[model samples]
Target chain A: MCIEHKKEDIMKLVPLGDRVVIKQLVAEETTKSGIVLPGQAKEKPQQAEVIAVGPGGVIDGKEVTMQVKPGDKIIYSKYAGTEVKLEDEEYIIVKQGDILAVIE
Target chain B: MCIEHKKEDIMKLVPLGDRVVIKQLVAEETTKSGIVLPGQAKEKPQQAEVIAVGPGGVIDGKEVTMQVKPGDKIIYSKYAGTEVKLEDEEYIIVKQGDILAVIE
Candidate 1:
């Protein structure tokens, strides 16, 4: 469920299957016109950065490898993924398919 | 966004990126006790058969490939994919990562 990265003291989670752990991008609180948006007015963030990737393995005799790796910014479906909190930090665990595109 | 398959008269839809087109498995209308369950009582089918697959291409410099091909039975997340209607046939467009497992 959770894996510790030796390089960083922060605990890293290892997602299973084609799942990827990501941190959601925060929505802007103010508009360019200098108008502050209410919490309810802000849309759900669909963009996120990949924190960890699952190990691609054989499923039903087919080999599945991960496409995106750590530090990759990605766009995902609005309703996809499971939310989790670690060390008071929020994250989402989503499958690679749920990711729509990788942002360069 | 729709592609035609030459082999079958049925028009095959090609999913983009890691997307996959699937036909949901029908749920049993009758219970094991022989009681007829109402349509609303039936749970959403999570199992589906792959109809067509997308040509996985470059994403953020990563070359992702299709893991499951046509005719493969798979189990997907309950809320994953978008429902689509084609030729009066209902189908779902889901990402390969949304697929939990391939049923053998």
Candidate 2:
């Protein structure tokens, strides 16, 4: 038998322009340099797990699809993304290009 | 006689696509519901003083100018903007449309 699912069970669908939705990696996990960051550190790096991506960037009035996909672990610039709170859970949505590099 | 100015004094010109640069108001100020947010508040409302604005939004392939300008104190969606640290000072850059409403 197949089970039915609610919309909440699926990631809410949001169409973005050359953008993607990222489920932010918990701030406490990732480390930088040779030392681990304490909880109270003022400048914690923002890392995220990709959830959804837009079709592609619009270049010269043409729509392009993205090279990245969901489930990629990415290292975005600290200054990237707009912080959003969805039902008390924080998420960030940003352009695909804003992602500096992928964590291998 | 007049004195010439440097680029630093000119707000580092950045031409954005319907975006704007905002000098975030010192988080220490601004109150909500008769209560002021303390420095330690986990969730501080991000209010900003507009320093620069883009020409306007791009609808289709046409460019449009912004309705607002520099020095406008506005309230933006908390989730809006990409943060940039310039000379150790934090500023947020976002599309003019991200500004939800102007504060009275």
**lDDT measured at residue A104 in model 1 versus the true structure, 0 to 100:** 48
Candidate 2 local distance difference test against the native: 0.65
Please, what are the lDDT tens digits per residue for candidate 2 over residues A18-67? 88888766555355565665543566655568887877667557554465
Runs in model 1 deviating more than 4 A are A1-8, A31-41, B1-104
| Cα error of candidate 2 at position A86, Å | 40
List, residue by residue over A7-72, the lDDT tens digit for candidate 1.
Answer: 456776889877899998765567679987744455565667999999967644556667788998
TM-score per candidate, chains pooled: 0.46, 0.42
Which stretches in model 2 have alpha-carbon errors above 4 Å?
Answer: A1-104, B1-13, B27-42, B57-63
Please state the error at residue A3 of candidate 2 in Å. 58
Candidate 2 positional error at A37, Å? 19
lDDT of 1 by residue, B1-104 (tens): 34643445654455657788899887657878898764545677688999888777753345778899999999999887876554456677887879999999
Clashing pairs in 1: A97-B97
